[model samples]
Target: MTDIIDLRSSLANRVQRWLAGSLDQMSDEELLKLVEAQSPAETIAELLVATPTRRAADDDWTDLLLRGAEAKNQIARLAGGLLSSSQAAEVLRISVPGVKQRLERGKLLAVPLPGGQRGFPALQFQRDGHVRKGIAEVAKAGAHLDPWALLAILVDGGAEGGTLLERLDDEAVLRDVLSRLAGYGEHAAA
Candidate 1:
């Protein structure tokens, strides 16, 4: 993370550009708190209300927007990589509808993008433009989990020093990863 004062000063400078008034009038702590909880969308909300879109004290519309941004960020981080449907189709040498069908059938993991678009996890695919063998089997076995959770487990380089993707080709290795996935499901259910 960055130094708080510098971050606050930088953001205040950006927001100050939107209005002629100086944002420095705000105390250091107040300025930090205002910008800290907010994302870019929250800044947009602030700008909108700065003009004429004020609402009641309790009617904060920015909350959901902030949550949406956070969720998107988390998804991208957990998946480690993503590709648009078209990109995935091109990489897999399949049609767009085929990509969608694979996603629906749990043969592929998708990162949910904003505006209802979904992207495939790029790490799940090999350099040969094919999905790693046995990945779909583990994904299907872990269908009880969310995409982010499954991706996290798949991408984690365990004590073995490589991702589960590397060893998933072996029968025992695939079964071991599947057992770990089952453990995750049991834990999640509990």
Candidate 2:
């Protein structure tokens, strides 16, 4: 995401600094490969910051570092947390059956519920720092609905013109949304 710079030299420099007294008497290439694997950019940044301990390397350390950093960033972004089948469905507002179908399709995870009670874990739906909440509103209403519908709506970025996510605080509206999303679980897996 930034200008390309030499990585191996940077890494070598960093290892020299971070592990100042403890750096193994290893080859520059060996150290570069290790740094390249973990976080080239971070390593390079470290080296740049720790200019007090610079070292010479074979060739273009900047290119190697940039490639390594790019790779690390992509891999980090692809990783996601796991969720129980029920929790996945509840958060997505799909039926338990629908959630299972998606799981079968490799669309979501199916972590086991606590005590093996066969319910979804709430933690599965959290993204970043925000999480879905206020399902009690639906419970309070006369209608009984599945939690997935609300979650799915929320995850979908709140639908076209409007969605339940925006009105989660409005007990009445949320209840209605939940009612509509519920009852699709007649054939859902337990």
Judged by lDDT, which candidate is best? 1
lDDT of each: 0.67, 0.45
> Can you write out model 2's per-residue Cα lDDT over 114-153, one digit (the tens) per residue?
3543333333344542334554343333123333333343
* Top TM-score prediction, candidate number: 1
Q: lDDT of candidate 1 vs native?
A: 0.67
Question: Superposing every Cα of model 2 onto the true structure, what RMSD results?
Answer: 15.6
Least well predicted 10-residue stretch by lDDT in candidate 1: 53-62
Work out the TM-score per prediction. Answer: 0.58, 0.23
When summed lDDT is taken over every stretch of 10 residues in candidate 2, the lowest stretch is 73-82
* Candidate 1 lDDT tens digits, 1-190: 1123434654465445534332434456645555774587775555454454323332233345445455555555545557889999999999999999998887887755546788677767888988888878987988877766776677666576667766678787788889888788566568
Off by over 4 Å in 1: 1-80, 188-190
Each model's number of backbone clashes?
Answer: 0, 13
